[model samples]
Target: MTGHRLRHAVRRADLPAVAETRRLLRDHLRLWGVPAMVDTAELLTSELVTNALQHTTGGAVLVATLSPGPGPRLRVEVQDSVARRPRARVVALPEDHQGTSGRGLFLVETLADAWGVTAWDSGKVVWFELSDPRK
Candidate 1:
Protein backbone atom coordinates (compact mmCIF):
# COMPACT_ATOMS: atom_id res chain seq x y z
CA MET A 1 0.00 0.00 0.00
CA THR A 2 1.13 3.57 -0.60
CA GLY A 3 0.17 4.60 2.89
CA HIS A 4 -0.01 2.96 6.29
CA ARG A 5 -3.00 0.68 6.08
CA LEU A 6 -3.91 -2.53 7.87
CA ARG A 7 -6.85 -4.73 6.99
CA HIS A 8 -8.34 -7.53 9.07
CA ALA A 9 -11.27 -9.86 8.60
CA VAL A 10 -13.73 -11.26 11.08
CA ARG A 11 -15.05 -14.66 10.05
CA ARG A 12 -18.52 -13.90 11.33
CA ALA A 13 -20.32 -11.85 13.96
CA ASP A 14 -17.88 -13.19 16.47
CA LEU A 15 -17.69 -11.06 19.57
CA PRO A 16 -14.29 -12.43 20.53
CA ALA A 17 -12.83 -10.72 17.50
CA VAL A 18 -13.30 -7.38 19.23
CA ALA A 19 -10.43 -8.06 21.60
CA GLU A 20 -8.22 -9.24 18.79
CA THR A 21 -9.07 -6.16 16.81
CA ARG A 22 -8.08 -3.95 19.70
CA ARG A 23 -4.77 -5.77 20.08
CA LEU A 24 -3.95 -5.34 16.42
CA LEU A 25 -4.82 -1.66 16.50
CA ARG A 26 -2.76 -1.16 19.61
CA ASP A 27 0.30 -2.73 18.03
CA HIS A 28 -0.06 -0.63 14.90
CA LEU A 29 -0.53 2.58 16.83
CA ARG A 30 2.53 1.83 18.87
CA LEU A 31 4.49 1.23 15.72
CA TRP A 32 3.17 4.45 14.23
CA GLY A 33 4.37 6.35 17.32
CA VAL A 34 0.90 7.55 18.22
CA PRO A 35 0.38 5.90 21.55
CA ALA A 36 -1.88 8.72 22.63
CA MET A 37 -4.58 7.67 20.17
CA VAL A 38 -4.58 4.04 21.16
CA ASP A 39 -7.27 4.32 23.84
CA THR A 40 -9.85 6.30 21.87
CA ALA A 41 -9.10 4.44 18.67
CA GLU A 42 -9.51 1.06 20.32
CA LEU A 43 -12.72 2.05 22.10
CA LEU A 44 -14.35 3.50 19.00
CA THR A 45 -13.27 0.55 16.93
CA SER A 46 -14.79 -1.85 19.45
CA GLU A 47 -18.07 0.03 19.31
CA LEU A 48 -18.24 -0.02 15.52
CA VAL A 49 -17.26 -3.66 15.36
CA THR A 50 -19.73 -4.66 18.03
CA ASN A 51 -22.50 -2.81 16.26
CA ALA A 52 -21.68 -4.46 12.97
CA LEU A 53 -21.57 -7.92 14.52
CA GLN A 54 -24.80 -7.50 16.40
CA HIS A 55 -26.80 -5.97 13.57
CA THR A 56 -25.45 -7.69 10.48
CA THR A 57 -25.68 -11.26 9.34
CA GLY A 58 -22.28 -11.45 7.76
CA GLY A 59 -18.81 -10.74 9.03
CA ALA A 60 -17.05 -7.39 8.90
CA VAL A 61 -13.86 -6.10 7.42
CA LEU A 62 -11.81 -3.76 9.54
CA VAL A 63 -9.74 -1.22 7.63
CA ALA A 64 -7.35 0.96 9.54
CA THR A 65 -5.33 3.61 7.78
CA LEU A 66 -3.02 6.40 8.70
CA SER A 67 -2.92 9.67 6.80
CA PRO A 68 0.31 11.51 7.23
CA GLY A 69 0.28 15.27 7.66
CA PRO A 70 0.99 18.02 10.12
CA GLY A 71 -1.75 16.26 12.04
CA PRO A 72 -1.77 12.55 11.43
CA ARG A 73 -5.18 11.00 10.92
CA LEU A 74 -6.25 7.57 12.09
CA ARG A 75 -9.38 6.14 10.52
CA VAL A 76 -11.07 2.88 11.46
CA GLU A 77 -13.91 1.45 9.40
CA VAL A 78 -16.10 -1.59 9.91
CA GLN A 79 -17.81 -2.79 6.75
CA ASP A 80 -20.65 -5.25 6.95
CA SER A 81 -23.42 -6.64 4.76
CA VAL A 82 -26.23 -4.54 6.09
CA ALA A 83 -28.04 -1.64 4.48
CA ARG A 84 -29.52 -0.29 7.68
CA ARG A 85 -28.05 2.87 9.17
CA PRO A 86 -27.11 3.56 12.77
CA ARG A 87 -28.69 6.13 15.00
CA ALA A 88 -27.77 7.28 18.49
CA ARG A 89 -30.57 7.14 20.98
CA VAL A 90 -31.11 9.88 23.50
CA VAL A 91 -31.08 8.54 27.06
CA ALA A 92 -33.74 10.80 28.50
CA LEU A 93 -34.25 8.95 31.77
CA PRO A 94 -32.07 6.52 33.66
CA GLU A 95 -34.67 3.82 33.20
CA ASP A 96 -34.60 4.31 29.43
CA HIS A 97 -31.04 3.08 29.42
CA GLN A 98 -30.77 -0.63 28.88
CA GLY A 99 -27.93 -2.88 29.81
CA THR A 100 -25.39 -1.39 27.43
CA SER A 101 -27.39 -2.44 24.42
CA GLY A 102 -27.73 0.85 22.53
CA ARG A 103 -24.89 3.21 23.24
CA GLY A 104 -22.22 2.15 20.74
CA LEU A 105 -22.70 4.83 18.12
CA PHE A 106 -23.18 7.45 20.77
CA LEU A 107 -19.72 6.76 22.11
CA VAL A 108 -18.33 6.88 18.61
CA GLU A 109 -19.92 10.24 18.02
CA THR A 110 -18.62 11.64 21.25
CA LEU A 111 -15.04 10.48 20.81
CA ALA A 112 -14.37 10.61 17.12
CA ASP A 113 -13.26 13.86 15.56
CA ALA A 114 -15.48 12.99 12.60
CA TRP A 115 -17.72 10.03 11.78
CA GLY A 116 -20.26 8.97 9.17
CA VAL A 117 -21.68 6.04 7.33
CA THR A 118 -21.11 5.23 3.65
CA ALA A 119 -23.57 3.05 1.83
CA TRP A 120 -22.18 0.63 -0.71
CA ASP A 121 -23.77 -1.64 -3.26
CA SER A 122 -23.26 -4.68 -1.08
CA GLY A 123 -23.65 -3.07 2.32
CA LYS A 124 -22.44 -0.08 4.33
CA VAL A 125 -19.31 1.08 6.08
CA VAL A 126 -19.27 2.80 9.45
CA TRP A 127 -16.13 4.82 9.85
CA PHE A 128 -14.69 7.22 12.38
CA GLU A 129 -11.54 9.30 12.43
CA LEU A 130 -9.35 10.54 15.26
CA SER A 131 -6.63 13.13 14.70
CA ASP A 132 -3.40 13.06 16.65
CA PRO A 133 -3.60 15.86 19.16
CA ARG A 134 0.16 16.11 19.53
CA LYS A 135 0.34 17.37 15.98
Candidate 2:
Protein backbone atom coordinates (compact mmCIF):
# COMPACT_ATOMS: atom_id res chain seq x y z
CA MET A 1 0.00 0.00 0.00
CA THR A 2 1.16 3.54 -0.70
CA GLY A 3 1.97 5.89 2.14
CA HIS A 4 -0.88 8.07 0.95
CA ARG A 5 -3.40 5.27 1.52
CA LEU A 6 -4.80 4.26 4.87
CA ARG A 7 -7.73 2.17 6.00
CA HIS A 8 -9.31 0.89 9.18
CA ALA A 9 -12.38 -0.99 10.36
CA VAL A 10 -14.65 0.16 13.10
CA ARG A 11 -16.88 -2.06 15.17
CA ARG A 12 -20.34 -0.73 15.81
CA ALA A 13 -19.42 -0.15 19.45
CA ASP A 14 -16.36 1.90 18.56
CA LEU A 15 -17.57 5.46 18.31
CA PRO A 16 -14.08 6.75 18.86
CA ALA A 17 -12.94 4.96 15.76
CA VAL A 18 -15.06 7.31 13.71
CA ALA A 19 -13.56 10.37 15.34
CA GLU A 20 -10.03 9.15 14.95
CA THR A 21 -10.63 8.36 11.32
CA ARG A 22 -11.96 11.83 10.79
CA ARG A 23 -8.86 13.31 12.37
CA LEU A 24 -6.61 11.28 10.14
CA LEU A 25 -8.57 12.36 7.13
CA ARG A 26 -8.39 15.97 8.15
CA ASP A 27 -4.68 15.73 8.71
CA HIS A 28 -4.18 14.16 5.34
CA LEU A 29 -6.24 16.80 3.65
CA ARG A 30 -4.45 19.54 5.48
CA LEU A 31 -1.11 18.14 4.45
CA TRP A 32 -2.30 18.03 0.90
CA GLY A 33 -3.47 21.64 1.18
CA VAL A 34 -6.97 20.46 0.44
CA PRO A 35 -8.51 23.14 2.61
CA ALA A 36 -10.31 23.07 5.91
CA MET A 37 -13.08 20.61 5.23
CA VAL A 38 -12.85 19.16 8.68
CA ASP A 39 -16.50 19.89 9.22
CA THR A 40 -17.31 18.12 5.99
CA ALA A 41 -15.00 15.24 6.82
CA GLU A 42 -16.52 14.84 10.25
CA LEU A 43 -20.10 14.90 9.04
CA LEU A 44 -19.35 12.63 6.12
CA THR A 45 -17.80 9.92 8.27
CA SER A 46 -20.60 10.21 10.80
CA GLU A 47 -23.21 9.63 8.14
CA LEU A 48 -21.37 6.71 6.52
CA VAL A 49 -20.87 4.82 9.74
CA THR A 50 -24.30 5.66 11.10
CA ASN A 51 -25.89 4.18 8.04
CA ALA A 52 -23.73 1.09 8.34
CA LEU A 53 -24.73 0.56 11.93
CA GLN A 54 -28.41 1.18 11.37
CA HIS A 55 -28.91 -0.54 8.04
CA THR A 56 -26.22 -3.24 8.13
CA THR A 57 -25.88 -6.01 10.71
CA GLY A 58 -22.09 -5.99 10.82
CA GLY A 59 -19.25 -3.52 11.27
CA ALA A 60 -17.94 -1.18 8.57
CA VAL A 61 -14.53 -0.55 7.08
CA LEU A 62 -13.58 3.01 6.26
CA VAL A 63 -10.85 3.51 3.67
CA ALA A 64 -9.29 6.88 2.86
CA THR A 65 -6.63 7.55 0.32
CA LEU A 66 -5.13 10.26 -1.80
CA SER A 67 -4.74 7.98 -4.73
CA PRO A 68 -5.06 8.30 -8.46
CA GLY A 69 -8.09 10.54 -8.72
CA PRO A 70 -9.42 13.38 -10.74
CA GLY A 71 -7.47 16.54 -10.13
CA PRO A 72 -8.00 17.89 -6.64
CA ARG A 73 -10.25 15.04 -5.55
CA LEU A 74 -9.58 13.27 -2.28
CA ARG A 75 -11.06 9.78 -2.38
CA VAL A 76 -12.88 7.98 0.38
CA GLU A 77 -14.41 4.53 0.38
CA VAL A 78 -16.62 2.93 3.01
CA GLN A 79 -17.27 -0.80 2.78
CA ASP A 80 -20.21 -2.44 4.51
CA SER A 81 -21.80 -5.87 4.39
CA VAL A 82 -25.19 -4.64 3.26
CA ALA A 83 -25.78 -5.40 -0.41
CA ARG A 84 -28.17 -2.52 -0.95
CA ARG A 85 -26.94 0.35 -3.08
CA PRO A 86 -27.38 3.81 -1.65
CA ARG A 87 -29.99 6.14 -3.02
CA ALA A 88 -29.64 9.93 -3.10
CA ARG A 89 -32.62 12.14 -2.44
CA VAL A 90 -33.38 15.52 -0.99
CA VAL A 91 -35.76 15.12 1.91
CA ALA A 92 -36.98 17.59 4.43
CA LEU A 93 -34.78 17.55 7.48
CA PRO A 94 -36.72 15.82 10.20
CA GLU A 95 -37.71 18.05 13.11
CA ASP A 96 -37.03 15.37 15.73
CA HIS A 97 -33.50 14.62 14.64
CA GLN A 98 -31.68 14.29 17.91
CA GLY A 99 -28.09 13.47 17.02
CA THR A 100 -25.96 13.98 13.92
CA SER A 101 -27.42 10.89 12.23
CA GLY A 102 -29.25 9.88 9.10
CA ARG A 103 -28.63 11.46 5.68
CA GLY A 104 -25.14 10.00 5.43
CA LEU A 105 -25.02 8.91 1.82
CA PHE A 106 -26.88 11.98 0.71
CA LEU A 107 -24.17 14.21 2.09
CA VAL A 108 -21.58 12.03 0.46
CA GLU A 109 -23.38 12.44 -2.82
CA THR A 110 -23.74 16.15 -2.49
CA LEU A 111 -20.43 17.15 -0.98
CA ALA A 112 -17.97 14.81 -2.57
CA ASP A 113 -16.12 15.85 -5.70
CA ALA A 114 -17.23 12.47 -7.05
CA TRP A 115 -19.17 9.63 -5.44
CA GLY A 116 -20.14 6.10 -6.42
CA VAL A 117 -20.61 2.48 -5.31
CA THR A 118 -18.79 -0.71 -6.22
CA ALA A 119 -19.34 -4.43 -5.66
CA TRP A 120 -17.64 -6.15 -2.75
CA ASP A 121 -17.28 -9.86 -1.97
CA SER A 122 -20.44 -10.06 0.14
CA GLY A 123 -21.49 -6.44 0.06
CA LYS A 124 -20.53 -3.13 -1.57
CA VAL A 125 -18.22 -0.15 -1.26
CA VAL A 126 -19.62 3.34 -1.07
CA TRP A 127 -17.13 5.91 -2.24
CA PHE A 128 -16.95 9.69 -2.47
CA GLU A 129 -14.36 12.20 -3.57
CA LEU A 130 -14.17 15.80 -2.51
CA SER A 131 -12.73 18.55 -4.60
CA ASP A 132 -9.77 20.38 -3.16
CA PRO A 133 -11.48 22.59 -0.64
CA ARG A 134 -8.39 24.75 -0.27
CA LYS A 135 -8.44 26.41 -3.63
Q: Judged by lDDT, which candidate is best? A: 1
Per-candidate TM equals 0.87, 0.71
Cα-based lDDT for every prediction: 0.84, 0.68
Candidate 1 residues 57-109, lDDT tens each?
Answer: 88899999998877889999999995475444333335557666777777887
Global fold similarity of model 1 (TM-score): 0.87
lDDT of 2 by residue, 3-88 (tens): 36667787865656777777777777667655565677667877776667667767788887765434455567888885565554
- Clashes (backbone N, CA, C under 3 Å), per candidate, total 0, 2
User: Local error of candidate 2 at 29, Å?
Assistant: 2.4
Error of 2 at 77 (Å): 0.3
Worst-scoring 10-residue span by lDDT in model 1: 86-95
Best by TM-score: 1
